[model samples]
Target: MRGKHAPRSTRWPIIILVIIAVILAPIIYGASSRNRTTKNQTTVSKKTSHSSISSSSSVKSSSTSSLSQSSSSSDVKLKSAWNTTKNKQLSAFMSQWQTEMNQTYSGTYDGQKPDYYGISFPTALENGRLSGHIKFDNQNTTVEWSPNANSSAKNQVLAVAVGQTSSNGYNRILYLFIAQEKQPKVYVSQTTNGEDLYFTETQNTALKDGFSQIYNSN
Candidate 1:
């Protein structure tokens, strides 16, 4: 009878210990799993923030690059305009003048033929106007004169002759560079004292007024 009671009491204590161990093991495991989940959420949020910052920086960089390219293109256009009117056009004009003067005055004026020795580069003026000087010498006499080329809406080329002398300041000659409205008919006006030489339909009064404007502007 004693042996049986002792065995039953020992069995009761062992069963109680097993039941407590089962409950405590689940509690500890649940707490550890919750901590791991919280840690993973924090790490994911940091990575997302970093990615957003990097994307925003790339957009700003692209904007800056575009602005730089636009500014460079604008500068190139300005330089092209500055270099368009070169010495070649001036040389051509001098050759034309030489041919015209040779035909008009015949052999020579004051022992030497009319010639253009030098020219000033055409410069941009106000309101789409261009001005330059053409220099020529005849019989040891040097003549410096300026040409004003005005461009208009109808693709018109109006050139004014401004004459200057050491004795006097400036003289207005009745010469022009005119083109037809839709044709490429460039001409230097002929001087007839009282007659309109080039562009037969134009009047002397209008020619004089136009020359005056160019002369005064120079």
Candidate 2:
């Protein structure tokens, strides 16, 4: 009866099942919590990435706008460099001979007070010359100048000092032009001054002598 009256093995199986269930419960819960934390981290990462991309896009847009404004300001400077009449006329004149029109130009010049702007013109110079005059505040001084080359019998630049002016301390209005003779172009300058100053004659004569040295017809 001692051996035969022993409890059935079925009770042992049931006890084993209960013990296994108790041991697995905490492990399953911990695994589920870890999975939920991982999911939350992934969501946060996605949000951060999206925000970074959006911020970068905004920065690029702002930079482009700033560049555009800078270019526009440069354009304003170039327009103001010459007188209104001469500016319009020269712009029209250059347009007629140009093949390529795209240019990015910005620089400084001597005459511009505080700051100067460097402007670029069209490169193609055909069989013709472009010219214009810039007048200063003084009535007697008129700068008659052309930067383009004259298509004459000699095929050379015709920059000359016609009126009275001096290169000394006095402020002379320069008639500026670009001479398109060959690959590299020359900048032609002419000075003008009132009759009262005898120094004006000296300046004019000196400039004329210098011009003759460079562009002598003979």
Query: How far out, in Å, is residue 92 in model 2?
Result: 25
Question: In model 2, which runs have C-alpha deviations exceeding 4 angstroms?
Answer: 1-18, 85-218
* lDDT digits (tens) for residues 1-218 of candidate 1: 45645644478888899999998999999999999999999999999999999999999999999999999997764343212242234334434553554322211111222221122112221222222221111111111111212233232333323222222422222233333332222233223222112223234453334333322231
**Poorest 10 consecutive residues by lDDT, candidate 2:** 115-124
For model 1, which pairs clash? none
lDDT of 2 by residue, 70-176 (tens): 99997764443333343334344333312132221111121222111111122111211222222223222322232333232222322221111343423332222
lDDT of each: 0.38, 0.38
Worst ten-residue run, lDDT, model 1? 135-144
lDDT of 2 at 64: 100
> Runs in model 1 with CA error above 4 Å?
1-8, 84-218
Error of 1 at 97 (Å): 12
